[model samples]
Target chain A: MTTIADPKAPRPPKPRPARLTTRGNTELYGWVFMRASGVVLLVLIFGHLFVNLVAGEGVTAIDFGFVAGKWASPFWQVWDLLMLWLAMIHGTNGVRTIINDYAERDGVRLALKSALYLAFVLVVVLGTLVIFTFDPCPSGSPADLLPSFCTA
Target chain B: MPDALPASATRKVPAGTLYRGREGMWSWVAHRVTGVAIFFFLLVHVLDTSLVRISPEAYNDVIATYKNPIMGLGEAGLVAAIVFHAYNGIRIILVDFWSKGPKYQRVMLWVVMGLFVVTMAGFLPRHLMHVFGGE
Candidate 1:
């Protein structure tokens, strides 16, 4: 019987794979962050949902005045702010992974990731600003433009 | 089944016939789907919530549109997706980081699933109460 060559036999040294050249444990840390942030998001998102949709008059209670009242409290403000940041980053990273997996061409991957990052930055910045800088009652605004509680 | 097949037929295995029914594969699929769902929801959530920055009348009118019963069911679905995604995400993290995690990955999946059920059982009743109990 003719003997076949062993594929597992030791081979000559070759050049290092290019992937090893990339920087440190960023991806590893990101994986960890996804889990840690997920736990936090569970609490933050559910709390937000519970308060907005369940407590008191449920969905009908979530009027402009309702939001104004909630944001007036430091607790709600911080909770929302944390939720905004965590969810945005988590979602962005998730999409980035998907893009990397599906976008075979380097140019396409770069374009898609760039767009994702831009959207992430825009939403997070705008959402954070709206959360912290929101004024239930704007100075000199018409009474009709304000929430009922704001006029009161 | 292989024995019943003719030797020629058995020798020529069909292309693209490999079944991917592993727990890990299913978990990855769920993670991707749930991740996309959450991402899309975030987009809508940000847009709607930013209505607060606009005039109160605009914000109130937009929110008022979400008061329908159908929206309530949608909210429930969102919660379910979040719960499953979060639980599975934790499992993935453990598998990646813990030295012994890969060996126990299957066990961890079941654990995560169990926790998901328990958490949902606790939250869903309260949510339904608020949904159908009326104002």
Candidate 2:
């Protein structure tokens, strides 16, 4: 029987395969994120539009007084809170993917992303505080400036 | 369930620590965070605005509630969220369609920072005046 050469044999290992030249599998994941986040954004955005623009009196009915009314309830508070958290995460992730795909320099990537993270944290923290602490009325307010319901 | 969200399917395969590939991964994380924040604001705004349909009295009552100091803070927060989301969104759009992706990255970041500075500058003072009185 003729002997065959070992293809599996490790030789010089093919010139050590160039330094810092490896294209890792990170991009595949970014592409997947865009598709996923896009789908969720579609739902969140469309649902938001339909509810605000189509339901009830439509666009004309919107105003400052209208806003004060909804925050009075716990159900709506929670609904809004969830929407805020989900959309921010989705949108931020989408942008982050774009940054990684394009930015070539390591320093630039780190700096850009650091700023993004800081902005994200500030918004999310502030938003959550507003939802739960919101009150429909306040003490010692001017009668004329306050909503008409205060007189009742 | 038909109402079940579609985004969940794609996110299931968490690109956890096991998959360290390239710089693109960071971008994905940022996109997700921004999307989630925007979604939250929309839901709240829609519901808050929905109060108008109930009645003038109800609407007025709700508006009055928003006068609380804590609620005022929240409003400030909402404004902050909107401004940041919009600013960063512009940056993302530029990178996507523009020819100057890398070149503009730094510029775009500064723009976002500038926007935050301007927005907060206007928003904070106005909010304080509304809540605590200018005097």
Scored by TM-score, the top model is: 1
DockQ of each: 0.47, 0.05
Residue A6 of model 1 has an lDDT of 98
Largest DockQ belongs to which candidate? Answer: 1
Residue-wise C-alpha lDDT for candidate 1, range B15-93, written one tens digit per residue = 5543576888888888899889989899889989999898787887787787676887888788788888978887887
Q: What tens-digit string does per-residue lDDT give for candidate 2 at B9-63?
A: 6674555664554434444355456555654554455455444444445555666
User: Model 1, residue B63: displacement in angstroms?
Assistant: 1.3
> Against the native chain B, what TM-score does each candidate's chain B reach?
0.82, 0.71
lDDT of 2 by residue, A1-152 (tens): 99986998776645565666648876666555554555555455446544543455533334444444566767667766776776666656655766786686999999988977776776666667766665455555455534567578
Clashes (N, CA, C under 3 Å) per candidate: 0, 47
lDDT of 1 by residue, A1-152 (tens): 99986999888789889787569989988877888898888788878877876667666567777788888889989998999999999899989999998898999999999999999988999999999899988777667655667766
